[model samples]
Target: MTEERPVRWLDEAEMAAWRSYVVATLRLRQRLHRELTDRHDVSLTDYEVLVCLEMQDAYRMRMSELAVLMGSTKSRLSHQVGRLEGAGLVRRGRDPEDKRGVITELTDEGLALLATAAPTHVEGVREHLIDLLSPQEQATIAAAFERVLEHLSEAES
Candidate 1:
């Protein structure tokens, strides 16, 4: 039988950092979701999806690309898109250059809704996260997460 290696465990400092990050991230998302749902009748994920499309040219993006950007499977994204479509917020169509590819486009109604909801979302973010951090702390957090994202992205390829 192969000998089992001893696992390195987190010490107190590391555990505190990790636990705080986990809980803060979860509660932050929940608070943001609650604000959006209460005021705008939109979930956090839906707001994120709309924001993603808005960042694209002409407020349109390929379904596959969107799925990747959102870190979601195509099937799950499809269901989410379907719900948005039913709400008249977005629509899907074939990409003209590639008939096999599907494209998602934000509708005028969607843009209006996003415009209305933007302030509430921004204020919530500022109040819940940004205002809590000093400028230096914000910069440090951004840099640290950028490194984390870059390392994880490299692993994906």
Candidate 2:
């Protein structure tokens, strides 16, 4: 049997830093989600899917690729795409190279909706985030998150 190692509990300073990051991250996402819902009748999840598609070539991506980009489960992303498709904001089609695969593309309606929603989203982000930080603080925060992302990507591989 393996011996039990002593726990390395967080000290007061570390706890404070961790708690601050947790609160800030949750509050940031909550505020953005609420504002998007109230102003655009769109959830943050839907907006993310749209943004992911928008960033792709031809504003289209394979369903599996889109799911990964959105960090959503296939079933959940499929349902979300269904809603967008129903709203005429997106469409699903056969992937030419792979008959069994699906493709998702932003429609003109989706682009137009994003155009209207982008301003509100940006304002929310600024009000809650960017405006609160100096340039150096912003850069530090970005670099820190980049490190976190790199770690996560490494874990995935």
Candidate 3:
């Protein structure tokens, strides 16, 4: 048998910093989610999906592609799409090239809603995050997040 190795552990400061980061991220997301949902009847997930659709060509995307963009499973995306469809915010159609595939398109109402809510969302972001940081700090934080994303992508591959 191979010899057992000791487990690596965080130093006290590292542990504290990690814990604070975790708590702050969770709390901030929760607060923002609550604010968006309460004010506009749109969940953060809905907003994210809408944003993704809006940025795509023709304000539409393949269902599978949208799922990837949202970091969600197809089934979950289907449910969310259904909700948005029922709200008159989106529409679904069969993909012309692939019979088995579906496409999602944002509606005019969805665009209008986004236009109304974006300013409030931007203000909230500025109040809670952006404005609190100096330009240098903001750049550093963005770079750090990009590094984390790259690491995650590499690990997945």
Candidate 4:
């Protein structure tokens, strides 16, 4: 029989740090979402999808690949992509390499929306998160988060 391991409880200081980080991250996400939606009529998730597409070589990527990058389930990405498509911001096409696969590309309208949204998004990020930290502090926080992300990626593998 397999044995269950005991939980590793966090100490007071560690717990406080964890709580602060969680609260800050949650608030940041909420504020960013509000700012983008209020100013640009785009959800934070939608903007992130656009960002991934924008970063691709031809401003397009396969749906499955995008799901992995976005850490989204197949159906979740399908729904999000469908909404973007309905808004005329992006379109889905059959992958030339594999008909079974779908590729998503940003439309001209989508690019224009991104152009409108990026400034507001950047400003919110600066006002709420980035500008509040010193350069060294930002680097340290980023490094710490990278480690956490690496652990998550490894756990999934």
Candidate 5:
């Protein structure tokens, strides 16, 4: 067998950049979550789920598919969906094609809540992020994130 090679460490600049990126991302998410929660009484996760459902063709998606899209486990998703259902913001139904599968659908109340909250969320995003970056910078940032996403997906595969 060939000798194993030692792993290279990040350079000082790279280490600093990585830490800064992590800190900034965490802070941004926290701020966004707080803003949404305080103003709309909705958790960031709930807002994400609502957005996902609203964007779907029928304002609904299979439970398993939603779990994957939300980057959550099926159990966690089920719990969240139950909470939303209790709040009368969402509903669950048996999938038409698959008798054993469940589908999550957004309620009219959920859509109304999303409509009310979306403008404020967009404003917060503009104030905290989009407005701060020049158009070219925005494009560059998007491209960089796309590359990172592609790299991560490839790694997973």
Candidate 6:
């Protein structure tokens, strides 16, 4: 049996920082989502999925890998992809190298949609997040998040 450790409660400054981060991120996502949905008729998640597929050399990726990249569960990604597939933005196919593996390929329609939506997404990102920060502050945020991501990823593995 291991000994229990005392909880290290956050102090006022820490709590303030935590709350600010939480609220800012939540609102930023909502604002971005609204902008994309209104202008492009695409949800933020679908836009992200399209972007991920477009980034690949073949404009395709295994569903499982895409799920990992999206930080989503397989079932959730499957449902999301199903919606894209129904809309003709993406198609699901068997992986050539692995019969059991499912691959998602971006359709020409998907690429076109992404091309149209990219500007809106970029502008939203800039307006809501990037443009709000100074160069030094941006660098600090990048460094902090990179460290946090690395630590969390290592823990997962």
For model 4, name the residue pairs that clash.
none
TM-score to native of every candidate shown: 0.96, 0.92, 0.91, 0.96, 0.92, 0.98
Worst lDDT window (10 residues) for model 4?
21-30
Q: Which residue pairs clash in candidate 5?
A: none
Judging by TM-score, tell me the better candidate of 5 and 6: 6
Name the candidate, 3 or 5, with the larger TM-score value.
5
Winning model by TM-score: 6
* Tens-place lDDT digits, model 3, residues 104-157: 999999999899878777887888889999999999999999999889878967
Residue 101, model 5, lDDT: 98
- Per residue, candidate 5 scores C-alpha lDDT tens digits across 18-77 of 998899888888888898999999988899999999999889999999998898999999
Residues 1-157, candidate 1, lDDT per residue (tens digit)? 9999999999999999999999999999999999999999999999999999999999999999999999999999999999999999999999999999999999999999999999999999999999999999999999999999999899999
lDDT for model 3, please. Answer: 0.91
lDDT of 4 by residue, 11-120 (tens): 99999999998998998999999999999999999999999999998899999999999999999999999999999999999999999999999999999999999999
> In order, what lDDT does every prediction score?
0.98, 0.93, 0.91, 0.96, 0.92, 0.97
Tell me how far the alpha carbon of residue 55 in candidate 2 is from the true structure, in angstroms, after superposition: 0.9
Indicate the residue-level lDDT of 45 in model 4.
Answer: 93
In model 3, which regions exceed 4 Å deviation?
1-6
Q: Which ten residues in a row have the lowest lDDT in candidate 5?
A: 24-33
lDDT of 6: 0.97
Task: Name the lDDT value of residue 14 in candidate 4.
Answer: 96
Taking every candidate in turn, the Cα RMSD to the unseen true structure, in Å, is 1.6, 1.6, 1.9, 0.9, 1.8, 0.7
Off by over 4 Å in 1: 1-6
- C-alpha displacement of 61 in model 3, angstroms? 0.9
Superposed Cα RMSD, model 2: 1.6
Ranking by lDDT: 1, 6, 4, 2, 5, 3
- Give candidate 4 misplaced runs (Cα > 4 Å): none
